[model samples]
Target: MKGTMVALGGGGFSMSEDGASALDDYILAMTKRPRPRICFIPTASGDADTYSERFEAAFRDRADTSVLSLFCHEPWGYSDPAMLLEQDVIYVGGGSTANLLAIWRLHGLPEMLEKALDSGTVLAGISAGMNCWFESSSTDSYGPLAPLDDGLGLIPGSACPHYLSEPRRRESYQHWVATGALADGFAVDDYAAVVWRDGAFVEAVAEQRDRPVFWVERTADGVVEREIPVRLLGQ
Candidate 1:
């Protein structure tokens, strides 16, 4: 069973004005099931209630939506890491990438996620969620935008979310890769998502036409940024 992943730079239910989006639908469609079971992990946002509520309201009608809160005062939804394997899609919410990783590690989630992936669960996330899947990423988790080398390493190279929406993300990421501080990788604009199947990049998709994805690489001349062609969703 090949693993699948959808890393969104930004703009999903969490960012959408209506708490619903074509990109969210695109993620559900990846399961190829009549009604996929999707679990939202909001650890990055410290399991924010509003975030989870938005997720439920957005996906409840279309998919079997559930929230797995690791920080709840009492047991909330599915607490066992093994339960994740039953999900058709595991969607992670955005917040502090650094905190998310630290908490997930303490709960032994990284290993379970790998097992779930190997068993064909589609792992998807936005912003911090997107950043956690790569070897390194440009993040604002610690304050100002900076490079973070510790990630789940599910995908090779590095990644930067909000490439276009966030100020300095593009220039800073490019500088890091160019200076050998980070590996060559991808950067995604708000509303854009990059797909990977079996740990290899498949394509890019976006909820809006103006949003794009890019491949940032280091060269002797410095850094090269190339805009990747994106398929506009809901067309």
Candidate 2:
């Protein structure tokens, strides 16, 4: 049992049509460590306090978890040694990418997360959270697609989540073709997530009932799209 890595969509909690058990199972599958102290980065949690509370309540009955929401208005404690070492999971919430990256680099979290992953720490997040894992992606909901000015690069290429619900899949694919900055990328729909291990996706968790996970990658000629049903143990 190796550690887990996850990327979430915007609808993670009550917003999720998928049952809570499915998400828990995904979390369980992601980590071999029990009662892991999870870090929830709600930099993208938005200004709605109620939504944030709802977001936190989503992870119910996990007594060992610790939530740390970074405030972009605050200064970075750049000198702290165990700044991010105490947690077992890093969860970023959905918000503006520009803001998330600005605060992340200011606080020097990119290096922190990379080192954490090296030690087998789990990473998870929705929307902006998921996008940070890729080299760069569509900054806007539309096709104003561009390489992330500041991406952690935890995962190479690009990731375009909310694939089917929003019109991001085709837009992302177009960007990949036009720029050639990103060769292959994932365009995951809502209530679905893909877990990448080493370099390739070895496991997938589909919280949705019918919606599939779209794995779109670019070839020398053009972009290719394939829809795969979500399962716990996927290859």
lDDT for model 1, on a 0 to 1 scale?
0.92
Q: Which ranges in model 1 have alpha carbons more than 4 Å from their true place?
A: 73-78
Clashes found in each candidate (C-alpha, N, C closer than 3 A):
0, 2
lDDT string for model 2 (130-219, tens) is 888887765662336455535666776677777777765567556664557664667777777878776566655776576567666666
For TM-score, the strongest prediction is 1
**Cα RMSD to native, each candidate?**
1.4, 4.1
Per-residue lDDT value at 169 in model 1: 90
Question: How many clashes does the backbone of model 1 have?
Answer: 0
Candidate 1 per-residue C-alpha lDDT over 1-235 given as tens digits, one digit per residue, 9 for 90 to 100:
2599999999899898888799899999988999999999999998988788889899999899878888862336548878898999999999999999999999999998999999989999999999999999999998998899999999999999999898899889999999989999999999999999986789999998899899999999999999999999988
Which pairs clash inside model 1? none
